[model samples]
Target: MAPEVRTNVNLKPYRQALALPGLRPLLLVSVLARIPFTATSLALTFYVLLELERGYGAAGLVGAAMTVGAALGAPLLGRLVDRYGLRPVLALTTVAEAVFWSTAAVLPYPVLVGAAFLGGLLNLPLFSVIRQSIAAMAPPDQRRPAYALDSMSVELSFMIGPALAVALATSFSPHLTLYAVGAGIVGSGITLFLLNPPTRGSDEPTGPVGPPSRRAWLTPRLFGVLAVSTACTLVLGGTDVSVVAALRDGGEVRWTGLVLTVWAVASLVGGFAYGALTRPVPPWVLLAGLSLTTIPIGLGGGTWWLLCLALVPAGLLCAPTIAATADTVSRLAPVGARGEAMGLHGSAITVGVALGAPLAGAVIDHTVAGWGFAVTGLIGLLVALAVLPTELRRRRIAADHAAAERAAPEQTAGDDRKQSPTVGGPNGELVGTEH
Candidate 1:
């Protein structure tokens, strides 16, 4: 006789998710891998500024090249992963990362910018891969917690990676810092290549099945989720620039890291709590909350501590919103097309970040730094409002379709009862249907 398998009502969602086979290692590797990935942006910015003796504008250009390349490449790389297997795509990207980072320091400015673009084009699809794996590994019920965990990992990486990069770059030779960053990235890529986690669920087809047409899966609802995904990040990216501007204006620029760390901690806490909830919140609702919370942050920009305090509400919504978006995309996309869908999700993030900083910067340039927060938050709010109606309509349609499906079988049985005549016995008791 087997022992009773009792369910614990008090068991947390994270624990339940981690109990799944292979999830723990996958998430662990992802967090470790993302640290270097997060570090690259800041490291590159410093190298351009300190080593090349270039202006911020030149550094921005290099960063823009990489961002654009990443935005354009994400879907293409995901499609490659879908067409080819994960290992081949990983191998190709790993080699590309190795080559670019290894030679980046020695390249001239023009060459460096071009190389950066190419490097981004072939950049490892780590973000997409991890999300795809989570979707594949975790059942639908378990995905929210898994994605929440992933978002928290992201917050953790952001919290550590840039600060570490800044410390190394400022304290040591920028050249050596670049070398160290390159080494970390290469090492991460190799580790992922070895791990090679599943990108499709066991029930999903693993053999050669041509991916479905975009029209099949790229429904209006999915597009709305993607739009929300973009808006969510736009708010975040804008807030980052706005925070810096606000700090600088208040003559508290030196404490920027501390304030940002506070904001990240709030997000981390939010993600953890959201995962434990028995019911899931829609991404649009979370996005709206995030945007609304963000709009009022400018009111507290007078001091670094005040700014940190102001950021808490918005930060609290951040990881939850991000996790919700990832979960929604996994649900909406077909299993075969999940890789590309996740890639598009990454692209949306890149686009949002690219747009946010400049938009916020422009607002700051024209007005007070506090207004930058207000404007970006307003934009995010507007986007949320725009998408809400469409999302509702889609849900209504889906509900109606489901109701119709449910009613069909019952209606057919009723019609059959009406059409058939029953034979009666002498005592007026029903015996059988007419033959």
Candidate 2:
């Protein structure tokens, strides 16, 4: 069936994107896969504190170890996907993750930390794979809407996954919840393996084998896209730290969760609105919007309500920034290297968070809570500016290269005709131009 085409982004296109063949299953499994990504940390924290009778300090360390493992693993797994195929890599990781989680449930505290790290390191790169699949499966024009929907789904997952994990852990047994989460991960992994979406080399190549080209996948344009994405996440991470600080300062630490929820809801709305626009906004513009909106959030120091209000404008830009960056990464990455590029994009996000949290906490410790927001926002703007020239130059070069390639075939055909003489008479006389 011919996929529906749209002149503008709207509700209809979003529906159409979902209805596309092969995409629905992918999206469904992707959401399932993401549950563990969002839920496991919360579940682990609870498991350590409640079941093992450990301190929050121990739980935090374990969680940090898991995150570090995932961060380190994402790019390597993506590179493997690019070099080999998706199914084998996913299958291996699926088995590893299931085994790790199962073992983790029974291990001692010290051993459990290491197991969690290994599990996270080998965690199925389902989210990265899904994002790459969307780029591969969706038509060019539909990608904007596709990415928007993708971003929205992630937000929904964040809202549901962590809360569900905590509730189940608190109401039931933490160990049981961890087992359940592991089972869900296994199911998601199996589903993805069965689906076996295509990567660059899924089919046999037509050309003869030779030395690989020295060209790299991390082109400057893609680097810019990744940078913008990292900056956006950095802002969010900093906001998280600053929000906690602000709430604690005001003695309303309990309201921190509520305030963040409000911020998240605003971002969800922004994703919908951004998706519906006829033209997607540029990455720089979205980043600028975020920085400008975020800068004032620090001024809302007195109460949680004021902080919530200040966050609304910045929150509105969050999903848009993410969606735009995803779309840009899809566009910038070559077909052969899409998996690795997307993996790097995912890595950029994790790195941003890893750095932003510590940076913001340091700032807050040295100065006041509000400066965390101010400092992060200013840094984001500076990063946007720093990459502007390089991004512009890369864009121009890419456009020129594309233009040359487009004209090459015509030029080659003309030269071939010029070299071969055409017969002008019945005697097969060669006709040559005198001019």
Candidate 3:
């Protein structure tokens, strides 16, 4: 006799999600990858300062290189994922990252920047792949928690990575810190490659391959979500530049790092503590509120205390909005298209940062630091208003579905008697739909 598959409909909700086999591996890989990704941000600046006698500008350039590469490369890598499976592609990317990150450890500033750019190119699709995997492997009700967990992991990396980099740079040298980061990324990548996350073993079946290409990305739903995400990120991206410039102006430039560090730490706290209670906030409204709240960033609270106070609310928006976007994407995307959906979402983030930085930097460099915040706030307002109608429509659809589900009968003796012959469930109940 064949072994009967286990079943447990009564499983505790939280426990049920935790039972998902692929979830932990996905989280592990995410945390590991982000270690180097975030730490490098801190280390690169020190590398420029120590070896090349370059200023913050070089560090800024390194940040731009990483963002630009990730933006350009995600879509292509995503397309490849649709054709090939994740394992080989992941292994190849990881190997390239390993090679480049190690080499970058000892290279001169120019060489290191070039290597960093290359590393960014090779690092494409990892985050999107993991997100797509989580969507495929987790149960429907469990998806929100999965995304929450993933967002939290990102926040964790942001919190710990720079701080760790600071400690290492203070104790050892920037080169040594870079070497350590390289080793960590390589080791983590190898682990992910070896364990191969469940997505490696088999392909998730996507019913009826969607459109011919990613042409559907321009569709209203995705485009709308992308717009909101980008707007939200612009607030974040622009705020970083504005704050840095303002600090520079106030002769508190050193505090720029500290303020950013504080912001990241607050974000970390918010992510871990975001429980199931926040589900009451509809995704669309949540996104708009998050974006709209960012308008305060432009407020010239010149004192450090006021600036710090302003950041907590601004920082709070970061993970929650991202989690909302992830939730929306998971529901809307077809199975195989998750990677592309996530890639596009990631691209929006990169584009926001890229656009926001230079635009704000120009204002600061030319006019004044404060205008940087105002310009980005306007962008945020535009994106939020543009996407509002769609968010409302989605909410209505969800409400109607919930109402339908509520009215459905759970069981009926008459219905049971009318069950058509064919398949039988494990409990010997008629499983086929009644004609």
Query: Model 2, stretches more than 4 Å misplaced?
Result: 1-9, 200-214, 395-435
Give the best candidate by TM-score: 1
lDDT of 2 by residue, 167-219 (tens): 89989999999998888888888888888875533343422233233265466
How much does candidate 1 score in TM-score?
Answer: 0.93
Q: What does candidate 1's lDDT look like per residue over 310-361, in tens digits?
A: 9999999999999999999999888878989999999998898889899999
Candidate 3 structure quality by residue, lDDT tens digits, 341-393: 77788788778767887887887777777788777777777777777788678
lDDT of each: 0.90, 0.82, 0.71
Q: Per-candidate TM vs. native?
A: 0.93, 0.83, 0.77
Top candidate by lDDT:
1
Compute the lDDT of residue 93 as modeled in candidate 3. Answer: 82
At residue 253, candidate 2 shows an lDDT of 97
- State the weakest 10-residue window (summed lDDT) of model 2: 205-214
RMSD, one per candidate, in order: 5.1, 5.8, 9.8
